[model samples]
Target: MDKVGETVLEIDLEALAHNYNYLKSKLLPKTKFLAVVKAFAYGSDMVAIAKKMESLGVDYFAVAYVREGVLLREAGIVTPILVLHPQPVNFEQLITYQLEPSLYSPKILVEFLKTAREKKLKNYPVHIKFNTGLNRLGFWETDVDYISKQLDNRDEIKITAILSHLAASEDPDEKEFSDTQIKIFKKISVALNERLGYSPFRHMLNTSGIINYPEAQFEMVRSGIGLYGYGNSAIEDKNLKPVAQLKTIISQIHKIEPGETVGYNRAFSSEGYRTTATLPLGHADGIGRQYGNGKGYVHIKGKKAPIIGNVCMDMIMVDVTEIDCVEGDEVLVFGQDNSADAFASSAQTISYEILTAISQRIKRIIR
Candidate 1:
């Protein structure tokens, strides 16, 4: 708890470990845990988060791209890395870095196979991604036979795992859709395994799925938000702890007269003489404009300082007329006192958007 500085993302490794163990406790005895460290570990420090997870004996690590996996490798992480949405163009880099790529299409499978062969690869590990319900990425269920056939012809590539993304695993109320997804995923697994004459590890659970559908836990579970301390489900959300807290310092204080405006667009007009504190954070740092114009607030000391006016690229103003604040007071953008969930509510968004939307350039202080 050092003095809060400008635009710093404080990561509590202890809290992260606590969250990891808590989620691990919920898993079945045979299920393995895979930490998703993609998007710079969800806009926190990836290298530090991955190292911490590795120390805790996480089964594997997943990233969104080949470069992300390469970053972990370059940092000396020996743990197996899964590239979730790898492209055909990066197959050579993936192979060269010994990173596993998630093959989601026939073209991707065929291209990666060629690259693997050219690199003299034998049983080169690759995960097959089936689009169960997300509809965002991965191959369709109808493409399962084609995928199996392609793998059958390509001996250079080893089918490491068959995985799918849950469309709504966090919302237990949406049990029907989640159950349907699980059923489809299981069917795909069975069909692929039968066709290939062997079974690869099957994983379909994200943070939400792991909590709501314990019965759906396959050989491995990929957790992205949960690892970062959010289950996004009512039941699971209660137990998990947040891993990041966006903290910044109050740079200046302004006392505006009645009718005066603040920030860009004159979005916030002072109703009366009021005090405002400008913090060293803005949309560029991931606090989007959606939080502007009294829509959001930052925690000053222990009180809520409502946001005022438009969010600039490098700064934002908060109405601190009532708070006993100063120029150098610590501002809690989103943390234990003012949870990301609370801040997101102000903008009619979710914790995921608030967390992942954070910019990468901000300084990360790991505790």
Candidate 2:
């Protein structure tokens, strides 16, 4: 924690490597891996995480926008990056940066093809996202024939892989639906390969897919939250190592007499004399007000301090009467000792939302 600010996210590169190795072990021998490093690598410093992944021999990277890919390229990342949802306007920049675009719909395909011709590109790598059941993005099942017709004798845009999204691969109750989605993806891949006269790589499994449907992990699989120490399962969740530890120091301590109030709107009134510690993190720092009023708890001296009153933009009050602590003492907001999953559950949210919602302003210290 040397040179760390008032509040910081300590990213353990060893834990990240452990999670990557753990997940990679679940795949077959020849299965390639694509790490989703979008949204600043789930709010854990994208450039740092990407560099680590590159060092670990990751096959590909996925980002939501072309600008993210461009930034990675500018940072000297030579690994192939897939822009999952690139707009037509960014097609030229994608080609210029050598970023592969996932052309899902007809419009994207046509516009990208036009851009390729205009840029005098040939055999540019691209991925086709087919809508198996998620229906969020990608070509529908009916668009298979249309896609083949559009790509007839077109060598400028070469299809490198076919991929799809899994709606609920981790839920046991939705296992049947996930299987159906896999079936649809397989059917589409077969039709596509027959029409194109050559089979390209096919991948449909994401993080949960790798854990739940390893048998269907075609040629490659993508890992996202799992690499950040979440598996959406009780068993695997216990095995993965949490990468980020969110911590802050107690800024000040207040001795409140009975009936005294704290924070805005007098949301908390001390029934009895209480000792409280004010932290430097607040809603602006991604600790939402929903976690206030005793919903979320922080760790101090191995004891839990429930939050009091409404969380402010720059401060939060926690009842520390039971814990032995002092001003400037380190407090665990969420991490190895205080699980983000448990903290998020108190706020009625998932760990993903809590982790990604951490503000980018907070410095990330990699260990």
Candidate 3:
């Protein structure tokens, strides 16, 4: 492939491996690891990242939709993929590719069983997601008995695991709430297992949960952002290496006079003579308009270049008066020198949103 045009996401496979081993060290020796490769593995290449994780010995892989799993399967990924939020329409394809579904509700369980029966497939592996307070998806604690009773006689679908999402695992102020979630998850799993006369893998830890609630590692843990780098805390972040870096080049440079405006709506007018650079990327590439008007910045020659005007659809003007930069100078959007977390904080968002929001149109290169 040609050298990437304007911007590219450089994916460091070694950094990815470092993060995996870092998180794995937090788990008990026998606990299993599931790399959450959903959202294109946090906006890195899904096939490539999944391939690396598979080679690194991840016990399983997970994706938010069935299509993501299908993509990996098509790329020859043989790891057990758990579809976190599978729609009923794709259940057939899910089974055909041996991709497991996180059956969270009565509708899903019943429909999956029905689908399995229709296809004459037996012992199809499926996971159950419980609503342990996140209340986002999954069966509620009160629904455990119902789930057990419904699956008691059905041999067509096999329950391979029971899992839950932590509501506020990273927030230290919500430790009590997180503890309650863990307790509720344990109770539901134990009750459901006793009633069903068998046990499956039971886990309830996310990236933050693995760090904040290690004792509750259960039989396995699912990691997402941490695998890509940000640990949601300064202390944890120090030990992890970011896997992706967004880079671009200064396409053009302009000298603005006092009272001269830069971009749309004249959002940034120069108070005095100022040097500015235009980068060939804008809100359309996942850098939202909210980052305009000096709210965000980029690194030019290791110096800060603040966004000056309203971020345009395909370009952004940044004040580079302090930096002696020219067209074609390298710009670091976020990576080793500029933290994605800090950049998102400037936009009043989180790192996950910024990282995953990166436009898929950007080329990804794995090192």
lDDT of 1 by residue, 77-187 (tens): 999999988888888888888998888888888888888888888988888989988898888888878887776766798898989988877675779998998899988
lDDT of 1 at 193: 83
Local distance difference test values of all predictions, in order:
0.87, 0.91, 0.91
lDDT by residue for model 2 over 1-367, one digit each (tens)?
Answer: 3434489999988999999999999988899999999988887889999999999999999999999999999998999999999999888788889999999899999999999988888889999999988979999988989999998988888899999999999899999999999999999988999899989898899889999999899999999999988888879889898888999999999999999999999999999999999999999989999999999999887889999999999899999998888999988888887777889999999998889899988878889
For residues 103-140, could you state the per-residue lDDT of candidate 3 as single tens digits? 98899888988999999887888899999888799888
**Against the true structure, candidate 2 has what lDDT?**
0.91
- Model 3: pairs clashing at backbone N, Cα or C within 3 Å: none
lDDT score for residue 291 of model 3: 91
Cα-based TM-score, every candidate: 0.97, 0.98, 0.98
Of 1 and 2, the candidate ranking higher by TM-score: 2
Residue 316 of model 1: what lDDT? Answer: 95
Regions more than 4 Å wrong, model 2: 1-5
- Which 10 residues in a row give candidate 1 its minimum summed lDDT? 229-238
Q: List the residue pairs that clash in candidate 2.
A: none
